[model samples]
Target: MSKMYLELAKRNLQRAKVRSLLAVIGILIGVMAVSAIGIFGESLKAAVLQNFEDVANELIVSPNFQEGYKYLDEKDISRIKKLPNVAEAIPIKSDSLLVESKKKKSYAVVYAMDEKDVEDMFKAEKGSIRLKSSCVVGKRLAEFADIRVNSKITIAGREFRVAAILEDTGARFDINPNSAIILSPEDFEKVSDVGYTMLIVKAESLEKVDDVKKEIEEKINSRDEKVVVFDLKIILERINEAFSQINTFLMAIASVSLLVAGVSILNIMLMSTIERTKEIGIMRAIGAYRSTILRIFLMEALILGLIGSAIGSVLSIAGGYAIDLMILQDASYVFRLSTLLYISLGFSIGVMVSVLSGLYPAWKASRLEPIEALRYE
Candidate 1:
């Protein structure tokens, strides 16, 4: 009986070769788009999360500011260091500046800190910072600036010798490797004369985040008059809220395509059943069960779905590769196992939808009167 069903499905598929091919192609394209999107989104999230973790262990502390920009003074850093469960706290007087060299120049966001902190931020590729009058440049900056080792560079109206060039790590930053320069906060002070602007705190563990944050807030508020530590969870929630909107938009668009596909499946299956009425009638006459007829049509539709979705998955992978090359050529971004799970889930759902779509047509096919079907054909 299964063999008979397969034979009928193959014949039916062959009868409308172009239509079947096109339907499968449509489904394949849709599935592939979804798969590629899943890979890209997951990879992006992981990269950003790693970047955040690199800044500190779990939580970060910055002054509560209305403009989303502010720095913790040196005194504030000293106090946060005293908090329990603290690991290592680093202070950076960071700001952006347009840097120029004899070769070329681009605007750079520069972080000013002690030489030790600056050294840890990047590996020197060309030369070493002399600590007194030399500056470290990012790899991209060195090539873009067209500067060689021991070259002179100027930033924020100050001159410094090029101590070292950093390896390109594809990270956006204010110098160690990217378009950034790391100098002593004291030296940065003489150039810009701006007050301390940022402090990066590294906590010991996840469990201590809230406790450390609360301690710092209470301690700072008690000592100062109006300063307050704004809640960080609120910020994360807001970011999630934005992503939710994006998720909704993508789902809605996918739904439109799915609905069209559903309608197409229903129409095609119903027509096939109408044409195969005599075959169904012959089976019924031979004592074949109605359930068997239904199964045949459902299986046919399921096969079509699987074929289409497989095509889509292939398309998606190719598209994903192209996008990865454009955006993160050097970065490691691959389809996650979860993406395969998602594809499996998608494939299963398509098969189920195809089966469901043929239900009425299949039932009608099974219920046809053998005498009437034979007389008409």
Candidate 2:
């Protein structure tokens, strides 16, 4: 029965090649919108996460102070280390300063992560620890700042040799606004005799991140003389939430195009049904069951959807590659495979919609009386 139904469906589709083609195109467009959004979201997330890990582990601890820098000190670092799921704790300070290397110059965020902790967090070809008189350069910063390996640079009247150059890892966030400079704990002390500002903490896994966060938060909240400063994770979360809303808006806008496609599909199917009213009546008169007639029309819709979606999906893949190229050229990030999965899923959704949209038209076509159809002919 299924095979016979499929054959009838195929024949009907073949009879209206142009209309079927247009319906498929509609499905393809809807799927393509989904694909583009999915690719951007996943790849951007990966790039951001890579920056997060580059800091340390799965977690970070900031002064839980209710005030500001006044509430944070070295003591918080020690306490955070004792918290559950925290394997290591390191103090870091990052601030922007005026810098000059030879005649070249830049204003950059100078990081003060623990030499060993930063070393453990990331690997370098040369040196991770800079002597009190030296520092390291991030890849993008090095290129932008135009400094060479082992070259000497001065920040805030303190001169230091460029002890190492970090390799490229697509860590735009960690780079801290497109430019970042690394300084060892010793060098950090040179900048400010005051206590360190940030604590780098590592967790066992993603599961442990929240636990560690809560542990550190409660510990800091207990202290009486503290000023609250936004922790890095909280700030990052706020940023992520904002992006998610933007993504939602983008999807909502893209849906307009999908709706247009849906209407196109409806119109094409309706027109096809009207033009074939006599034929529909003849089939009914010849003893075709309503169910078979419905199946035949629905199959045509489904086939059209599949064709369009497949084409759109292929085009989306190509577009993703183009996007990847543009990102690499601009920010050194690339799309991941999960992004493609989203594209495929989007196409499938389009296919499902195509089938659904045809139901009413198909049912209408199946109900024609043979006598009336012949009389009209």
Q: What is the per-residue lDDT of model 1 for residues 126-220, given as tens digits with 9 covering 90 to 100?
A: 88764566777777767877877788889877898888887776643222347677777666876776555655555677556667777877887
Clashing pairs in 2: 65-227, 65-228, 66-226, 66-227, 66-228, 67-226, 67-227, 67-228, 68-227
Q: Which candidate leads the pack in TM-score?
A: 2
RMSDs, each prediction? 5.3, 4.8
List the candidate 1 regions with Cα displacement exceeding 4 Å.
1-22, 41-53, 56-76, 93-112, 122-126, 133-162, 165-182, 185-196, 205-211, 222-260, 285-289, 326-332, 367-371
Q: Which ten residues in a row have the lowest lDDT in candidate 1?
A: 225-234
Report the C-alpha lDDT of model 2 over 289-356, residue by residue, as the tens digit. 88877888888777777888888887776665676667744323334667667777778777777877
Provide the lowest-lDDT 10-residue window in model 2: 169-178
